[model samples]
Target chain A: MLNEFFENAPCGYFSFFDDGKIFVFNETFCKLLGYDKEALKDRNVESIFTLSTRIFYQTHFFPLVKMQGHAEEIFLSLLTNKGQHLPVLLNAKREEHGGKLFTSCAFITVPNRKKFEDELVAAKNVAEKALQENSELLKAKADLQQHTERLDAQIQLVNKQNSELKQLNHVVTHSLKEPLRKILIYSERINDKAQPNILKLARATKQMRVVVTGLQQYVWLDNTPSHFTHIDLNDLAEKAAAQLRQELNADLLNLHMVKLPSLEADAEQIQLLLYHILSNAIKFKKDEKAEVTITATALKQNIFRSVEHKYKYEDFIKLEITDKGIGFDPAFKEYIFDLFRKLHDTEGHGLGLALSKKVATNHFGLIEADSRINEYTRITVLLPLFQTTR
Target chain B: MQKNILVRNNVKVFGNGTQPMLFAHGFGCDQNMWRYITPAFEEDYRIVLFDYVGAGKSDRTSYNAERYSSLHGYAQDVLDVCEALELQDTIFVGHSVSSMVGLLAAVEKPEYFSNLIMVGPSPCYINDADYIGGFERKDIEELLETMERNYIGWANFLAPNIMGNADRPELGQELTESFCSTDPVIASQFAKATFFSDNRKDLFKLKVPSLILQCSEDIIAPVEVGNYLQENLSNSTFKLMKAKGHCPHMSEPEETIMYIKEYLG
Candidate 1:
């Protein structure tokens, strides 16, 4: 009765020698493997295992059993005679019987259990992937928060600086202006050998007043709020050129202006931008004839202002103003954009190009200068065709 | 300084002889795997065993993901253990992936090692156009899945026992201890590093004489791989063993020892 029970047991039973040669197995084990007793003779236990299971058996399961004498509840898949994988829950124990050592193993086929476990593992993997993605999103949000906070702090600092500059502008316009007027009037009244020196002093004071006024205009650009509207660049360029012609009283100021695309920008600021650039070309002329040409092209590209700031624009109008004049060294291309930077010590307070850059920046644009010594100097202004309300 | 390195890797030194024989374990296990093979060498050579940082009783806190991400990191562990013990002319015995690890160490510092004994070693596990590594990428993925299921089973088995000894935390330590206990995450990373790595290019850099002990039916390192290694590695002796599967040092230690002794003689 015990022999019949062993053969008819629900779980498959097998015994292998320490060298992995199978010596005995139950009928149920043979049926599960779809192999006859004769066919199973002289076969190793690993012969029935799939590739991955054989690896697991050799690397993990075999080692565990050898060290701990038994391994329970191990998951492994066995290959049957018909070449189908049969997932099984395996329990193994190393035993010494009749002065010889061998291993006894019981296998319970668990197809349903294996399927459920795989589903659970798949779900767990999905959850883990979701958690990883969520954490990455949270990190990105935190970085953006940090960036916004830094920008807010920078804006507050700029506001404070602008208010302080406003106070300085008030002092220069009111307090310094009255004293300079007194000096010029008193110098003109002097009638002696000192009269020539007095005239020189008055001329210096006049130049100081022009510099002070230019400083006021430069500071005002930051204080005033910009009002953007659709402005025709052709009209603005003509008006600027005509004004320069009237002011310089020189018909030799040749201006070849191209048809430019109308873009949404601050009309007043753009007008100032055009006037400053045209005036610089005329002021730094080689001789009496000041020849300037303006051309425009539309581009879809990115504007790189600095390493940290890059703005992508779908549509941008690039305006190039080239002047055949006595251009300064190309090294001072960026330096010429500073408020008090003058390369040739010419007439004017050296704030023209700086004011032009300020106006272009306020309109979300970039102005760059490319020049060569005693050749043509080209000033390129790239402005976005469309403006978003700030 | 030596004590810190020793503790970090759980370095154990024992022998009756003067020359050092450093044994490096492979993935999925620790230095305890050498127990079956180390006894034969204990009388004739100094036996040095160490758990690579994240495995066994070594310092788990020192497991840096970036450092242990490649075989080079494990190679550094071998070198560190060598430097700490001040071993010279060492006969290095490495099993499985540690074969490549030992190769890297010997290539980096050839002065410290004299011979490399590799058991069931494969330079690459994934097959390419010209080389057959005996596994597809899919098979490795399945292995990783199986590993995860087993680790989960272990965790589930330990959870209740851990909760029962919540008041006695010291008892919890013993309850959690198991043979070849490796951190599951580190094991997975180690698996990726081992199976996915291609150290074929590093074979030419080996200056030390070596022995390749290829098992009969090793799915991990097939006979073709052993032949490939013998052909590629200069001044190397290849021996095909009767023992089947990987880990011949454990399964057939007597034969493993005889080959080492013969080669050393």
Candidate 2:
């Protein structure tokens, strides 16, 4: 029976001398490290791990084994012969073989680290990108009073001219939207269309969008469009929450919403923007506590007339959504909106925030964030309110 | 079949006597932990020794997650062997983690074991109102953090290691390198369970006649914890091993085995 087990045992088992030389390497360890019986017998423990980590093992880990004579279930990385790391915990005994001491041990490996790291990075990149996009929008808003002044001077004093300018601005902004969307689509499509340059083109398309937003008057809010529609902020809140709950697994989340007042504006884009922010907050949770709140209220419609976004913005409305959960590195705040940028090695980048940013700005709105790591993150969306507020 | 069951861990049954005695190893060590103590019992007893799933020579693949996350999983493994062997009126001997495991096994299946000889058993790792196990939550947390940072093969990362931990100097780094180890996740969970688990209830429910060995300066299982087990376990005799550190069986094996023989008599 012992012979059968020695050949086909489930867990890793082996032994090493106090000097960190291998006296035994079991079938499991051999399989995990992809080493042969001959290879293992002659290998010193130090030669098995990589240089940076081998030194660690020599200084910290192996010494403990000698002193303690044994250890149980310690999670650490082990390097295989082919140079791949195996995460394992070891339990050993101080064996007296003749006059010298040795460690007789066994262990098991977890294969979840890489997967977890990927998920963390992807998710982080997406969140960071979203926040970065919001920052760009805020920066645009700050440049607003100045741009509005310059543009106002260009087409001031003539009502007919102002109306004509509005039509041109509409055409320019609306056309920019499809092409921008097409850029993102084509870039992602390039992954399959031109696989070699997928990463390069992907990066290009994202950078191109930033330049477009920065170079041109990103948004041209009409002063008082006849087509302005009444948007029920409460309805938008409910819609966003319903969709977010479904996306993030409602059973795992604590979502709360306050009755919000209505404000009329670009309903389609406003709805789309809210949905993205809320969904994002929901996606970032992993066994940690998650909570989200979305609330909106009418802003006094007069701020629009005073605001003058390059001579547009006939209204003002504010919507707030707050999430308390794992946050990101502040150092990457600028890179958050960059496509393919990852923070925690999880998944996805740039799309959520870029799309949300586009929807908000194209609809004559602003979005910004105030965040601290492992703490609360608040996103504020400022949009133009329609005259008939509910 | 029962011999085969433990054979995967290289646990050989030595000696040729009718009265069977099982020796359980402690944490940080394996069934080989009973090497010195078993020699004394061999002449008079049918000696049994086997490694726990996480210990020496055991089948690493056989270590089931849902199964071996707690000490009771080990207890069940002991019972499995006892049932397989059809051993009765057996004297159960356990060291460190296995001591508590043997106690739990005896409580659950008393028919096989007549007396449990617990060498350095700790019911809990925390200092409760009455018990002082010489470990604090922070201390355990630091130990766990140490494993996460150092002991586990955290740095030999495949590629693009996490900037924070994959680089920083970890606590208990020295302890981590001694041997081939288990996965970090399992190690963390095990540490939490071992250090934080409160088995005061298990002690209260123990029924078998037992001998509780307490080492004078055992870092892992303190003297008070042994006394606590003795106080709770009726018909249990308590003796202080004149030694220190976690494994008295390794440090002072001669005296440790001598005390066991006297307890048996």
Candidate 3:
């Protein structure tokens, strides 16, 4: 009865010596591999395993069984004689029979269970991939949030600087105006013995008044609201050239104009911008002739003031103004646009480029300058053709 | 700091004599792997054993994926243990991948070690045009897949056994609680670090005298790799044992001990 039970059991059982020689195996084990008991006399246990399973057996199974004296629920695949893989759930234990040490193993063929387990593993891999992608998206969202916060901080800083500039404008208008008036009146009333010094004081006070007015205008650009209207650049450039020629008292101002696109912008600010650029060309002329050229082209591209503020405009106008003037060092090209920044001791209060930059920024545009030490200077202004409602 | 290193690596030190003998375990198992062989040296040498941060009962929270991603990270662990114990002129015994780990440590700090004994060491595990480390990239991938499936199966099997045998501690212990049990994620990472790593150039950097114990028919580290190490290493001895498989110290401890003793003598 015991022999019949051993031969007809549901699981296959095998015992191999420490050298991996098969010493005994149940009839069920032999039948599972399609070999009779006599045919498996010299066979080693690892011969029936698939290559991966063989590696697992040696590296994990054998060592584990040897150390712990038993290993359970180990998954491995065996190669049958018919050249097909048989997935099996294996359990092994180290046993000492008499004086010899051997390992006895029992395994049940688990084809259907292996399929289920494979599906589970595949599902796990899919879930892990999805989790990884989700985390990446979360990280991207966090980066965008940080960028927005930085932009907010920058906006606050600009607002603070604007307020401080307004306070300086107030001081220049109220505090310095009364004192300059008193000095001019007192100098005119002085005796002839101090006439030279009094004249110098009067001239200096007058120049100071002009600087105070320029400072007010620069501060007023940010305070006043902009009025948008359809303005033709060709008309504005002609008027600006005429104004500059009259202001400089030089008909030698040679203004070369090109047909430009009509765009909706602040007409007053655009005229001021044109006037300043033309006046600068004539003022800083190399000799008697002030040669200035203005051209405009339409573009279709996005404009970025900063990385956070990207203006996707349907149409844009790129205006280039080139001048044959005494250009300063190229290194000070960017610095020349700062309020009251002067590279040379020229006439006027060094506020032309600063006012021009302010007008460009107000129209959601950008202005960049390029120059050599003695060559011509080119100022490029990029503006949206049609302003979007803010 | 020294106490923290000891706790982090689960370092154990106990022996009879003054000379220090540090044993580094291989990829799959922990320091318990040296249980069978450390006994023979206990009479005359101080034995040191430790688990890598991710394996065994070492502090799992101390595991940094970036630090332990390379063999040098593990070598740093060896050096840290050496410095923690203030060991000098130590005899280092390393098994499988730890063989390369010890070699790297010795190369960096040669004064910490005197002699090296490597059991089934392979500098590289993938085959090149002229060298054969006995595996292709696909084989290692398949091994990883097999490991994943087995870990899932083992976890599933152990969960119920633990739940049902709450009253019987011995019964719970009789289950798949073996020395090779490791966290699946860490085991997979360690496997990638071990198999995908190529340490062929590092062989020339060793200055300490070494012994390479090459086992017969080791699929992981074949005979060609042993021969390659013997040729490249300047002060090294090579031995091909009759034992079969990747781990000889476990399968044939007596032969392993005999060869190690003969080399040390």
Candidate 4:
């Protein structure tokens, strides 16, 4: 029974007689490494196993089996037919039978048993990376949605405004028809008794026509974008002066000019922009004379200011309009360039300074306002010179 | 520059060739409100349709509360239209709130208009001594609250519309933009100014020939009040149309147009 038990163990087992020689090996041990039991039988241990493992077996496995009588569950590496290493655990013991010393070993592969643990770690890493990517993608999608919504809203608002503007134009234009017809009819209907009022009505209708033209011009000028064209500076100044001649009593302006230059720019916008600035100067003119001077200089050199986003400019034209107006405090620096920003309750849209800045920016230049409270205001405008390259 | 008796933005004789009729629409509508009624009278009368400032297609920039607060402002608007058009010796028609506006305009310049026709008239909104204006300040306040709540509701309602693609509209976004465009505060204030206004006292002193077409079973203008007006008005006719609801022009257009044609004839 004892011999049968020793020979028929579940795993490969073996015993040695204190010598580096195989005393016994099972069918299972040989099969585990893709070798036949008979082929490995009685083979020198060093030849069948690798040298390092063979040395370890001789030194550790032999001593432990010989001295301790048993060495159970030890890890070891074994070589296969293809020269690949195999992880394994060995069990062995020192034994004495019939007055003979012997060493025995038993083993099974271990790397296969570690598969569950490694799979757990890999799954954890994958989940963490997927979670990070999902959140980032979600955030990016949300930001894109918000941007699209805002743009769509702006577009819709613009369309609605355009529609209303068209309707307004229709109403205003259609309105002129009846009044114009009445002027023609009533002028013919007047006799001596009703002649005075009738003639007055006719005159009013003609005046109405003038008012309509003014309305159309105001709307047109307000809507047009700042497009560049050949502009006459002196003409624009004089035109503005003429436009406000009736209201000049409010400002009591004495417009004077130094030698000025005319060039290509957004003609209507520049006209309007200058008009706004000059008007603001007059509207807030100090106790001094409401006199304005216009001058120009060739700004060919580069300007190095301590500001970010330096302009890639090759040349420029500098124009300065100085007015002895009730200038604002210097503390309001750059505020004049803000749209609808008014420091005083003066007449006209608060677009004067803002419009000037817009024109300056559109010209690939900048505008600076230098002034002292209750003193004088100087508006400097820089214009980019056009260039061509081969 | 020949300023007459300052008849509230009035232009006396605006148009020629047998002075045509002029129409003034109520809030939220332009002269296009005249569309349902004008064609009935267009064969015989040259009709004029114009929007008021801050409403419909009128100049929104010109909207100032102090200038456009009362029927007086609306009356001024009528006068301005007449002056702008050079209209004269024509019948004048007004709807809803503009009904009182037309009456006041006629009073301002009697020579400019042959008659005044007021549709779906309401003289006052709140009840006072021997008078029923049909609405109170609290009612208008509640209306404001309702509008505020409704605006929020509408925003949520339209969320889907804006969120979904342009082709596949989400119902949510559609409602939100529609409600968002109409400022709740403005609509409430406008409603209070509209529903709570009182212009009944001006009726007893009417000088021009006038026609009042009141809708029967109207929540805005009750039938009993219409009868009471017929008894009290000095030179006016109160004819109740066979229609229900505040706006017969929307629910029963043909009946409303027939009544208008009858009065016009």
What is candidate 1's lDDT per residue for B36-81, written digit by digit as tens?
8998899989999999988877898888665677787788789999
- Each candidate's B-chain TM-score, in sequence, is 0.92, 0.83, 0.92, 0.78
lDDT by residue (tens digit), candidate 3, A250-359 = 68678787678899898888988989888888778797788888977564334444663233324567788999888878888899899889888877678988999999
Per-model i-RMS: 12.7, 19.9, 14.2, 44.8
DockQ category of candidate 3: incorrect
Q: What is the DockQ of each candidate?
A: 0.13, 0.03, 0.15, 0.00
* Ranking of all predicted structures according to TM-score, beginning with the best and ending with the worst: 3, 1, 2, 4
lDDT (C-alpha) at residue B74 in model 3 = 85
For residues B81-195, write the lDDT of model 2, one tens digit per residue: 7877777988998876677778777865576988998877888877777568766676666555445554323434212222222222342343233223444454555556566
Best by DockQ: 3
Stretches of candidate 4 off by over 4 Å are: A1-390, B1-18, B151-186
Taking chain A of candidate 3, what TM-score results? Answer: 0.59
lDDT of 3 by residue, B1-265 (tens): 8999999999999999899999999988788888889999999999999999888768887876656777877887899999999999999999999999998888766879999999999999999888998888988888888888898766743342333233333433533343677778788889898988888877876889999999987888889999999999999999999888878898889999999999989
Residues A1-390 of candidate 2: C-alpha lDDT, one tens digit per residue: 886687668878877764456887677778888888888895666566544344234323543444444445545567787788676656555666787666787777666754565466567657867996798689779788777887778657566776776776665557765787797887776547656677777776777665445323323223433245767766876677677667656554566787765655667556666776665676665345458777654422223434422222133555667788677766665565544455655444445565566655655566666567887667777766553442
Quote the lDDT for A125 in model 4: 47
Q: Name the lDDT value of residue A210 in candidate 2.
A: 55
lDDT of each: 0.83, 0.64, 0.83, 0.61
Every candidate's CA RMSD = 18.3, 27.4, 19.7, 38.0
Candidate 3's error at B91, in angstroms? Answer: 1.2
TM-score of 1: 0.59
CAPRI tier for the interface of model 2:
incorrect
